[model samples]
Target: MSDNLARQFLLREDVVFLNHGSFGACPRPVFEAYQGWQLELEREPVEFLGRRLHDLLRAPREALAAELGCGSEDIVGVLNATTGLNIVARSLDLKPGDQILTTDHEYSALEKTWAYVCRKTGAEIVVVKVPMPLTSEAAFTDAIIAGMTERTRVLFLSHITSPTALLFPIENAIAEARRRGIWSVIDGAHTPGHIKLDLEGIGADFYSGNCHKWMMTPKGSAFLHARPEVQGLLDPLVISHGWTAESKAPGAKGAFGNSPFIDEIEIQGTRDPAPWLTVPAAIQFRKDNDWWGVAAHCHALAQDTARQLGELTGLAPLSSPEFCAPQMVAMPIPECDPLVVHTTLFERYGIEIPVFRWQDRCIARLSVQGYNSRPQMDRLIDALSELLELGAPQIAAQG
Candidate 1:
């Protein structure tokens, strides 16, 4: 599909990496750019952060805002999706008996954020279970909407769930939440750089995502985008010089004065801003590479890999090709402990994959990046076929 040089990724050898959805593999050029910015930061710590970091950081957010179809004021660069969610989680002034509604398929770390908030504020976390072997967008939306009650104050969801890798239909949910005066905070950890993102369209009060996972940026590169009206409600998880607007500092939220939402969350104590600043470069690298075509190609591979694995394992897939996510697929395997299966894949076969236990089912999540070839998928298929057909349990005993 996309045969451009920009599609070139520098993944490590000696292992078949099919877990890009967990943490994205940075492209060679983007990696170089990340290093270059890091070098500049070390070269002049004072000038780089004090004099130039604000505008330098803003440029990428501006470009990314355009891509995300939201104003730069609505988006603030954060360390990761977890960090972004924490900002919103801490800022929410939840009271006792208030409810935060969410589905069972949410990311664990994000769930922890809400749980911690609930513990502090006496808010109840209402978990609505969306039936598995999930079929349509309507089914997902309806399940969540049905869970809303009078006590529901916040609705937290994953744009692309980490455990299942399914994309939720949030627009209708967000629109409905607004009508009922409920807050919708989405954890879009695997959304950016994987699928097309429209922050305005989602109508979410707060949205946070990671650029490192799918955008192919260096680690610690991510952002949190919030709506204008709701932004005032957020307090940064970390407080620094940006706490007071009366006297604007170098890292202060300029022009937009006394916005406790942004002021409270945006400035964490000084660390290297190099990764955050390198986002524009990563965006440019993808643009030059015809990223759309690459996505299509990767989706095809995901479909094929899922099919092969399913045929070999005789385990039903979580979703079919139509409902199945393009970049990643979560497939079930035979009755086996996940950690044991995972160790067999990695330690025994050197297959870098994610085998996780969720509820009653065991899931094998496969992610397809540009660097992944059919041969790589073939390796996985062969390994699995050997395990199943050759009586892997018996083979394991001998080893």
Candidate 2:
């Protein structure tokens, strides 16, 4: 089954691609659908972009909203999670002495975005260190909530952390933020198809996620979601045609007839909506392929591999199984140069994975998709054994 699924992806045959969590690989059918949209746009540019774009864009948003369990009007397509997050970070009317509380495990790009926002707005960023080897959800939630104070304006967090690949229990924290009048902005870059999502149930003031990562859409497909009551607070990153005087008025409809939240951010400028349009095809692909079953198989394989690596390196996992990502694991490694480990794995073994130093630990983050197989995992283990000089398994351990 894994071998058959591998053929559907466009990944290179020579490389053992273990980095699906970084930028997802689009399946052949979905990529074809993406190209079809691009062809349609080019064949009749004016008609597609001018007369039909508003309606054309609506279908994908509705499809995505259904999957995310949110109102279609609350979510708008954006280039990536980072772009969607930037739209929210910049739009907030944060004042001097205000603080944005966030975890240390956030994606670096978003950290930089908040820093830029801080420089301009005089808002400060407060980092909370999530305890290592996270085994308790209550502990995780408590740590985040404890970070908030009188001046904490926004509670920024990753639904699934990028570097560590831990699935944070953010629901309680989000609810607490709402109670305290601190806006909750969730970065769901590794969420979406990676895990079950209910944006409305989560009740965040703002949320953003990438379809390109877990939804198997082409690059440049992502979304930002804002609740209806707070939609007026956001100003679009670009003051495009969607920003009508009427949009600013309370309870007024958008210039494009959609809600101001959708029209203002989605209708930014002339750009390829092909990737965004391919979202339905991607969602359909998952259903047709029984992706939940595939995901389960991938998860078992990923955890098994993580177990093997942990035994070999004599290093524990960053989190317990319940808190770890379903299909991605950040395996702790013996202290070494991260760059050397990454380069050697790629150059010598033709294995593509992300190895990096996150604070005190060296990590090799493994992402298992439907296409990955036991042999590829074996190859990774073999390579790492040679690289790290760990001869054999010390003792097989279970989560």
Per-model clash counts, in order, read: 3, 0
TM-scores, each model vs. reference: 0.93, 0.97
Indicate the worst ten consecutive residues by lDDT in candidate 1: 247-256
lDDT of each: 0.81, 0.92
**TM-score leader:** 2
| Clash list (residue pairs), candidate 1 | 234-261, 236-264, 236-265
Q: Write the per-residue lDDT of candidate 2 for residues 275-343, one digit (tens) a residue.
A: 999999999999999998999999999999999999987898888999999999999887777777788
Query: Which of the numbered candidates is closest to the native, going by highest lDDT?
Result: 2
- At residue 67, what lDDT does model 2 achieve? 97
**Segments of candidate 2 deviating more than 4 angstroms:** 390-399
Off by over 4 Å in 1: 1-7, 245-264, 391-399
User: Residue 114 lDDT in model 1?
Assistant: 88
What would the per-residue lDDT of candidate 1 be over residues 246-342, giving only the tens digit for each residue?
4233334433253444445555567877777778888998898878788898999889888878887888887656656678999777655567667
